[model samples]
Target: MAFDVSVIIPVYQRQELAVSALRSVLEQKGVTFEVIVVDDGSPDPFVLPADLADNDRIRLLRQPNAGAAAARNTGVRATSADWIAFLDSDDLWLPGKLAGQLAFARDGLLKGWPHLTAVMCGFTQIDLPSGSRRHRIPVESWNAAELAAGCWFGPGSTALIPRNAFEQAGLFDETLMRLEDLDWFMRVGLLGGGVATWPELAVTVRVGGRPSVKMLDDAVGRMRAKWLEGGRVDGDTRRNLAAYLALEQASARRHAGRWLGFLGCMTRSLLLRPRLRVPLRRWWTEDPAAAPQ
Candidate 1:
């Protein structure tokens, strides 16, 4: 039977987590799909659990140590499905993830929500080791503007999209090495295609080493570099993208003790969105006399 969606997982050293993610996909309730695992050159020679490896729906594609973007891109190219879902190796889905997303897509189709170009679902943040302490984002409508303006995304793992849309948007930037999701999503947004999010938590996004603060900074820097590398812009998008990149830079700079840099960023933000100038004006008030705890 042909699958409705292919869940692609890019695996590195986290074999156990990858296996668990695959199991979660396999356990997806009421959904007919296949799990495609891209072993992104994991140094560890951990093999898939034999008991589950033989399953027709779970296939592994071995590749050299390409970045995660390359791995996922290869997986997308190899899968045999019109729709594709992305899952990070370390994240796990709720019991009904695929079913929920597919159902959402079907409803959108019935209601004529275009081809349902993209679908995003919410996620629960989990602390590792014990995997305890869960916090979910408050349910809210997925705002395209907010996503474009740069807000926290639980994970790229949440996206379920039409294969054709991805074809149009092109694959994740292999050179990105990180922050590829936001970069890809931003490019996808530029295409003027619609993106939707389910708002309901459908996956447990593990936040430990992979999604670290440093990783975020690195990704943002890379994204900014790429965003500008596209050359001169002739629209509101360039204005907004520059401002957003500055905001990201300012925040990073503030954390790095570059007060002047931070101010410069705040200036850009205010410049881009004049209305925000009045509200975010006092972010520089520093506390001078705090004792070491």
Candidate 2:
């Protein structure tokens, strides 16, 4: 049977979270969709429950440990749906998420805008520790410069992209273990197709679980170099990107207890963009005492 949308979920050693994500997709209303779950060689293996195993709407594929980017690419290749939406194994789509995006597309939100090839909705980030939720609304429209300033798409999980756009933008960079979503979105922007936003929240993302700081730093550093070499962004956007990268490096250093390195990174970031507000705010809020003398 033909599907309106193909939901690609990449799972790696997160069986329980993946199962929950699959259930959320299965429960979506007003949209004919199929779920493609790619198990990226989870060490312990991923097993679908008996109920899901027999469901024709769900397709499970497995491959050696190739990271989330590869897994997503594999899932995309396995589907024939015209529209593609990605959901991280740990994230869940609220009811009507797919229907809402389809409505936006049918109502000319994308058709009226020549540059828009995708639509994404807002999302709520649930702080795992405190159970507090913060709603985030990404920009309704964005150009390359705006995207270079930051990852305005929020996350890969919130986006519903057309297959043409996906093909043009190419697959996510497999080398990037972190910030892969941002990298792919930046590429999409470079391809001259922007993303439109739906104001309502469509997904709930669980946050607060931390990964290795050094690894994050390396990934961001690689992303910075890649964009720089692409030369798609202007001087101001490049400066902003540099400032953002520096701030991320500083945060990583701070997390690693390297106070001096953190201070140095913060100083460099400020020098790059003296009026940069994010680093200054993070400096004061994260550790006022560690602020440079």
Candidate 3:
């Protein structure tokens, strides 16, 4: 039977979490979907649970240890559905996530909004160890210009995109170990594809240790070269991206329990943007261990 959506899961070393993520997909109702699990050469080879091994709706593919971008590209090639959704091995989907997003997309199509290449929903970030829920972002729409300025939502788990999006925007840049989502989304926005949101939380993203500050700086530098060179992005967009990167670095430092680093990043973020300076200044006064509400 034809499927409404193809859920591609890219797994690296996390086997247990991969199984749990698959279970969440299996629990999804009100949608016809197929699951493709691409194992990026985990040290301990991924095997389906005994019960799931006999299930025909799920397919497992194996490849050498390429990064998540390559694995997702491989999965996209094998997908038969017109719409595609991606879920990392460590994240999860809430109940009816697919059905609701699919309905929203259909509505957009009926309203002649073919430029709606992707539909994203809100997601909550849950910090590890403490497992405390951080701030919840409600879904909101963004035009091409707004998206071109900066990333606004979680794309890996919460995005339901048409297969053609990859064709037009191009696949995820395998070279980017970070910020591939932002890069791809910006390309989509440039191609006249506007992003819409479902206006509800539909995914849970587990936050863990982040890459080092040096690594993040390197990634941001690459982005600056790619987008800001030769006046591709205007001055406002450049500052917007700078402020966004600083805030992201601050959040990473906060998650890693580096107070001085967090403060430094926050200072740069607030200085560059200044719109949210007062509220964020108050946020810094709170306990560092406490997750943002």
Index of the highest-TM-score prediction: 2
Error of 3 at 150 (Å): 4.3
Q: What is the lDDT of residue 218 in candidate 1?
A: 72
TM-scores of all models?
Answer: 0.78, 0.88, 0.86
lDDT of 2: 0.78
lDDT (tens digit, per residue) of candidate 3 on 185-249: 87787677867767667788997767876667777777778876646766555666667777878
- Which of the two, 1 or 2, has more TM-score? 2
Residue lDDT tens for model 2, 129-157: 88876677666545665565556566788
Best by lDDT: 3
Q: Where is model 3 more than 4 Å wrong at Cα?
A: 135-137, 148-150, 252-265, 277-292
Candidate 1, residues 179-205, lDDT tens digits: the string is 576566666666665566565668888
Give one clash count per candidate, in the order shown: 0, 0, 0
lDDT leaderboard ranking: 3, 2, 1
